[model samples]
Target: MTPTIPTRQPCPPGACICERERLVEIQGADLRILYLTRQEEKRLLDRLESLSSLSDLEHMQRRMFEQLGLRVTIVPSLNEVRSMRGIGINIDELPGLCRKTRQAIPAAIRRGLEKRPEIAYELLNANDLLRDA
Candidate 1:
């Protein structure tokens, strides 16, 4: 017998390639992976582990939003995320997580990047923010 797979609800109209506006964006001419929670981090990593190419990024994004079911959108830069309020990221714990994630992502991404280095170029920093408020 085959197990059934759950489908993610379609994103609301007007959001970009993502389910909402908080999934992807750009800042300072570079892409910033924003609004990541501890939850999203695990999902994203689970998806990443199954990928063999950079092209898989889109699927990673889609898979994540599908699991999350939020009003996500994928913009081009983090600057856009910076310009918004309640952008799905809870800034209250940002500074601390920024420090920890920066330090931890290197080791965490090392093995993954061994297969696909494009991710190295795409996000200089991927901060996993939580909105646990």
Candidate 2:
């Protein structure tokens, strides 16, 4: 089933495309891959960095997953996981993550997640992409 793309809010004439839609689409067959723009990424990283406890992170995680279908796992260190694996954010690297630009965070996330068929299936199913298949 083809996923329904969300409509973007109206922008002023002559506005840049980036200012119109904050979600960046990455091509894939099995999953609808979307990621935040640089500005949005920085905002998210800043918010994550400000969390004072694990509960706060968990709350944010749930909200993000439910709202945007983005999965983020908190890890003590980035070295504990493979770079090309899941979207695991090292709590220690929040500042660095915020500094990454030119869609670097989103690109890394797409690379890490695109390889996992199960994740694709799960996300697709959750979004009801499989309902009419």
Best prediction by TM-score = 2
lDDT of 1 by residue, 33-66 (tens): 3445555556655555555654464465465445
Off by over 4 Å in 2: 1-35, 75-133
Worst 10 residues of 2 by lDDT: 91-100
* C-alpha RMSD of each candidate structure in angstroms: 16.1, 15.3
Q: Quantify all predictions' global Cα lDDT against the true fold.
A: 0.39, 0.43
lDDT of 1 at 96: 16
lDDT of 2 by residue, 55-95 (tens): 55467778766654555654322233233343334322111
Q: In candidate 2, which residue pairs clash?
A: none
Reference-based TM-score of each model: 0.28, 0.34
Q: Once superposed on the true structure, which residue ranges of model 1 sit more than 4 Å away at CA? A: 1-34, 57-97, 115-133
